[model samples]
Target: MNLDLLKRTRMYKGYNQYQMAEGIGLTRQTYNYKENGKSSFNSDELLRITTFLDLSFKEVNEIFFDNLISK
Candidate 1:
């Protein structure tokens, strides 16, 4: 997982992990795990993160889809 980007984005937005988690409808622990590179996010979580961060789909995809490819 792109944990660095997650942490960086949150900091860029002036949010703590707990606040970002709340904004994105995730538990703080779960969001911390993702930010710490200890877990992967499902699609729903991905959508929530993008929405909460006010990121365009292109930005979200570029940030999180570095390892994915079109089939």
Candidate 2:
């Protein structure tokens, strides 16, 4: 995952980690772990993030799937 892009986007949208966790029905620590790459985001969490961030399909692909595409 492109964590830097994700963090930047989250900040740009004016959401803190706690708010994002609430929005996505996760605990703050869970969100932090996922954000920091200690854990992965499930598809359901990804969907919630896309909706909460108001992200476009292209943005989702860039932030979540860029590594796969690069390979």
Error of 1 at 12 (Å): 0.4
Compare the candidates by TM-score and give the number of the best one: 2
User: In order, what lDDT does every prediction score?
Assistant: 0.81, 0.92
Please provide, for model 2 over 6-64, each residue's C-alpha lDDT reduced to its tens digit, 9 standing for 90 to 100: 98999999999999999999999999999999999999999999999999877888899
lDDT, candidate 1, 1-71, per-residue tens: 46787788779988998999898888999888888878888889888888888876556765788646444
TM-score of model 1 (CA atoms): 0.80
Q: How accurate is candidate 2 locally (lDDT)?
A: 0.92
Worst 10 residues of 2 by lDDT: 62-71
**Candidate 2 regions with alpha-carbon error over 4 angstroms:** 67-71
